[model samples]
Target: MKRSTLYKDELIVQIMGMTDKLQRRFQSEGVDEERSWMLQQTDNPAVISFLKRATMMMLHVIDAIVALEPVNGIRIASHLGIPRGSVSKITRKLVQEHVIQMEYLPDNKKKIMFRTTSLGKEVSKVHLALHRHVNMNVHALLNRYTPEQLAFLAQVQSDILNTSLVKEDLASIKDDPPPAAENPPEAMDMRQAAQEDPIRDLLDMLHQLDSANLSKAKDLLQVVFFAGHNG
Candidate 1:
């Protein structure tokens, strides 16, 4: 292999390693323990119960409602770049948990709007503090890098986001023929299997992030990479 190709391969391996590490860290029991600690700080049974059951996506929906009270499901979906169906499902659960409630305009009784309840606000407050703590640490670590280094890192992130693998994988999946009845599940092609890759899902999620959130994500990645190197 050419020296450049070798270096590119090494970079790919490093990136994959970093992504795997992040996935493991997020899914680890330690994170759950930390969440449990956060929950213990609050005494409200409703808040505690809701927090315990809330997924990250659910919390994100609550945050959206907090920011955009009296918002409809369509508006929330547009704001978050998620599907309306997903927003509807999450909002339904949020209403059941009493963290969020639905409202209808007096002028249009059929129009549904959402807003956080008192318990929802409390949960939002706790989640906001959690985010603040994480962001503070990430920002402090990121501050150590010079502006040029940060700029280069940002460029790297952009390049990764614009990689062709994601496009090719998606395109190939879309162009594939439907499986024949005689084909066993194990007969699935490599391109079809690529659809199940978590990295592709991660890339899709990154693409959905707005500029501010993307910057925060880059900072968090830098922190994770720096910590990995030191450890």
Candidate 2:
């Protein structure tokens, strides 16, 4: 029984190793495809600029939704750790921008309800795609490690995730408005509310670059990883 249990544990670890490798392989290819898609979508300078601001804005809107009760503007902002006035402004802008919906509660005249619209959901999905693109590329090299190596790597990743890496990433995105007529300063302001996030910066970087950086980043990543230890 003891031997059987130990074998199962080892097997699980081995499987984890394989899965991690597969994840990296998938990400490497996926980042290539994602970059292609991003390029096609952002061919115009105006579009690229607008997307940068839009991406930042949408993240805060989503954060509010995830953290709050989908209640009205004031309450949602209050619950989600944002200023009520900022929430009200962003909510109104989002509704006008057609990324979210606001409906008055039936029983209450003063209270209103808010939720992501179909458009909002689509934007959110795109944002998620952008996030995944960055994550896969950044962690793609981890698959090269052995099972024991992967176990240690995973712990390190978890620790990093829980720390300021996230904050550092968010702070990288610049809040300056894009030069497009379609995307106004109001758009930039709302977006700036969430610009202090690392994930958004990573996505922005991925959206701006080609696959060449992917390989370089991967090689540099391996160098950094291997530099710390004996094996």
Candidate number with greatest TM-score: 1
Writing each residue's lDDT as its tens digit, candidate 1 over 110-159 gives 99999999988998888888888778989999999855456556656665
Inter-residue clash pairs, candidate 1: none
Clashes of 1: 0
- lDDT tens readout by residue for model 2, 64-156: 664453667766766667678877787777777666787777788777888876656555555566777778977787666644455445555
Off by over 4 Å in 1: 1-8, 27-34, 168-231
Deviation from native of the Cα of residue 9 in model 2, angstroms: 43
lDDT of each: 0.81, 0.63
Residue-pair clashes per prediction, in order, are 0, 3
How high is each candidate's TM-score? 0.64, 0.38
Maximum-lDDT candidate: 1
Q: Looking at candidate 2, what is the lDDT of residue 161?
A: 59
State the displacement of the C-alpha of residue 169, model 1, in Å, after optimal TM-score superposition. 10
Model 2: CA > 4 A from native: 1-55, 63-70, 74-81, 141-231
